[model samples]
Target: MYPVIAGGALSAMTFPGQTAGLSVFADPLIEQLGIDRSTLSLSYLIGTLLGAAAQPAIGRLLDRFDARRIIVVIAVLFSGVLFALSFAQEIVGLTAGYVGVRMFGQGALGLAATTAVAQIVRRRRGLALGVSGAIGSAGISLAPVLLERVVSEVGIATAWRLEALAVLLVVVPIALTLPRPAPASMEVQRTSTGTIIVAGYTARQARRTGMFWVLTGALSTSAMLSTALGFHQIGLLGERGLTPLEAAANFIPQTITALAATLIVGALIDRHDPRIFVVGSMAAMAASMLLVGIVTPGILAVIYGLVLGLAGGALRGMEAAAFVRYYGLTHIGSIRGLAVSISLAASALGPYALAVGAEWAGNFSQPSAWLAIIPAGIAILAFMVPQPSPRATRPS
Candidate 1:
């Protein structure tokens, strides 16, 4: 559990997963250095994409060695890279540092950590991932205040140095406490370069099928709505008549609801059918958007954030749980990487699309609310995929 929590923490320490404004800092930095957002964004984007593209190779490596050692190296170097980002003075320097930070901070840390958590638990997989995720989110929520306080008291470069040190210190105990891995089974120890990927009908295998595409499309749609709604949450609330501070206060519901729903969804996934929970959550996402579309009340906006946060949070945690439950743990990391890469790519469309729509429509009412079909439609397609008929797909 310690390693699981820490593993997840390392992964989430990215630009977006970081305090959110780290990316915004580039704006000011760019102006001072005479660079373009497109250039910086592209550099950052390509680096992230490159890192994600490496997950399959990483997954294969995990199967071959004691992954804890690799994690240790990543943890140490990741902090060093983040520390370097703070001192970057020019656009070229900043771009180089940013690439390294995202690669270690978000790319390797996140993927490796979650993969570790998956390896450690069997019962209540959702809850395990959720608890680990919560720790990572706590890091994110705390980052804004921490960075501001530190930078003000000292300096930005100093603050980054301190933060990197703090991350290393926090992970020390996790590194010390990781369990000794058992010997690989005959199947796990296969000598030939035979494919670990199975062609048998399974959720992940089906994920490669059209049924999976349907689920992916639906989820991708909902993901887009979430991305838009999240970006404009404050603006939407302000329009509904809350003061800026009060509109900000409305995010409180999200933290509480998301935390609770994550734990509950995990426990439920272990004992019941995961698809039911998934479909229900996606349906809730649709309803939330639809409600906000028809009625722009202040309270409804709060309600929307709360429900969407819970649904989104739960879905994020359950995504792997559902896949593992329907499939199994072998090659889980590889499968999940592809799923996340696709989902994250889809989600990227949200904020950009929302910006364009908000500019044209002058509000979030129609464009924001009209995107309810994604998750709901995915839920219907998820219902179509059959569970691998032979529960005995892999040797226990």
Candidate 2:
């Protein structure tokens, strides 16, 4: 229960590095730094790509060291990075700031938070993860609104410093409060209920299996398409005849739908095959992309929001559970780390790809429609792939 609470807090804290969180300050930063939107997007692309490269190593470190300590370190560094980012006056400084926040806040801290919860809660693990994700995601969804108020009141630079302070005050203590892990030399540790064995395949062995690629593909598709849509939300919907406020209002339905879907999928994953959720998420992504190509300012826009929310929430709910269920807990960090790295890299590519596509076609519709094919193909592959047996393998 303590781990669950701490994990939820850590997850919520990741908002500082998430796309939705950063989007709040985009307009302000562009104006303050005297840069065009394209230049800012390019910086984000390079920074996120570089940040994505750090996850595999962070994941490996999580497997070898104390996650609680690692999380503490990450939170402190993340806070410092956010503070420094507030002072950036040029592209190079802004890019470096993005690298720091993305690496520490998004990549390392997020992986640690989920891995910590997944490591300790064996029985009813799905419910624990679901609750944790729900809490975190709810906070993430509300971040833009909350930060907007702060930015409006105190200005972007001070808002950033306040956010940094919040991270230090909130995240560090919760991380410290988590229960200590059993010693690494212990193969079997006794919980309050009974003894449990820590077992799972190493990262290398998991990579050799077909299920790994199937799951990764499904997860990456959601990350990429959703991120692309999010990064270009105002512009994309503007092209479809929606005002900026109307486009932004759509997030309310999307966030509500995402919260519901995340909880439902989380509860169900424990009893049902995870592949069902994987395939369903991809289908939702496909539908949303196709819908985005033709959506209007009213009902169609809301429906698009719901479908996109479903895609994002369902995938988020099931991702940790699928990895733990299929791969086991012993080496879960390293295995899931590799998958996260790929997903993050895919997310980096998404916005840039869509931006370039939009430039080529002179509108978002053509590029959005073309992107649908990727997830549609992945959905078919996920459905065709057989489910892996939940057998524990000896860690190397």
Candidate 3:
């Protein structure tokens, strides 16, 4: 539980490096760097793509060493990047800064934290992740709002510096308290509750099964669809006659619903087949996207937001559970890293695709309707994925 709590805390630290946090800096960056939206957007896409490309390597490190060490190093480097971002004078500097933030914050830190928690517990893995996810989600959801206030009060540069200080002073100390993984002989030791140890497939062995690809497809589709809606949420809501304030106000309902879903789904995952949760969540996302496409009223929009929140929570939970449940913790980091990289790479295209679709169709509605099919398809694939044979293999 201590490791899980520490992991959750570390997960929250990534908020400073996530899209929501960085979105607050958009206006400041444009003003300071003199670059148009497209230029900055492209630079961000490139940097994020580069960051996604590094997850496999980072995952290998997690497999080789204590996740605590990897997490601490990433925390330090992520803070430095945030601080450096405060001084960017040009596009090159801005892009470089993004590479550090996205790589360390979203990719490596999350990988390390989840790996740490997963390593420590097997009998109650799902519940631990649920608690961690709930805490991390709340922190991440509030981060942009808090940072916005800070930026308004003290300006963007100081906000970045303050964020850096928070990581250095606050996060690093807590992260250092995380325990290392148990030794190999103790890895399969069981509790008095009679939970039997199941051997797991290695990353390479898991990839050979259709289940791997199906799970990846479902998870990545959820990431891409949700990210697209979130990126254009304001514009989409406006098209349905909601004011900026109304659109922004939906965040609280969304976050609360998501938090509830994370906790509920976490408990269920411990007892039921994960595919059930994954497929159900994807179906919810599909319905939500369809609702957004055909929006006409107040209750409908609220329902859409709530369902979208459920999808988001389920995606996070399943992504955390799938690799550990299928591939053993022996190389869980590497297996999950491969999946995370694919999802991250797919997420980069979400906004780009939606924007292009909107431009081609002249409104967000058509794109929203078209995007609905993606999750629906993935849900079908997720339904077909069989549980991988729990035969653990030595890392090659």
Cα RMSD for candidates in order: 5.4, 3.1, 2.7
Model 2, stretches more than 4 Å misplaced? 182-198, 389-396
Minimum summed lDDT over a 10-residue window in model 3 is located at 183-192
lDDT of each: 0.61, 0.86, 0.80
By lDDT, the better pick of 2 and 3 is 2
| Residue range 73-170, candidate 3, lDDT tens digits | 88788889989988878999889988888888888888888888888766678888988888888888989989999998998779989998888886
lDDT score at residue 338, model 3, on the 0-100 scale: 87
On residues 84-162, what C-alpha lDDT tens digit does candidate 2 reach at each position? 9999889999999999888988788889999988877766778788888888988888888899999989998898899
By TM-score, who's the top model here? 3
Q: Give the per-residue lDDT of model 1 (tens digit) for 288-369.
A: 6776664444666667768877776676556656665544555555555565556545555566676667678887667656
Supply every candidate's count of residue pairs whose N, Cα or C atoms clash at under 3 angstroms: 3, 0, 1
> Which candidate tops lDDT?
2
Name the TM-score of candidate 2: 0.94
On TM-score, who's better, 1 or 3?
3
- 170, model 3: CA deviation in Å? 2.6
* Pairs that collide, model 2: none
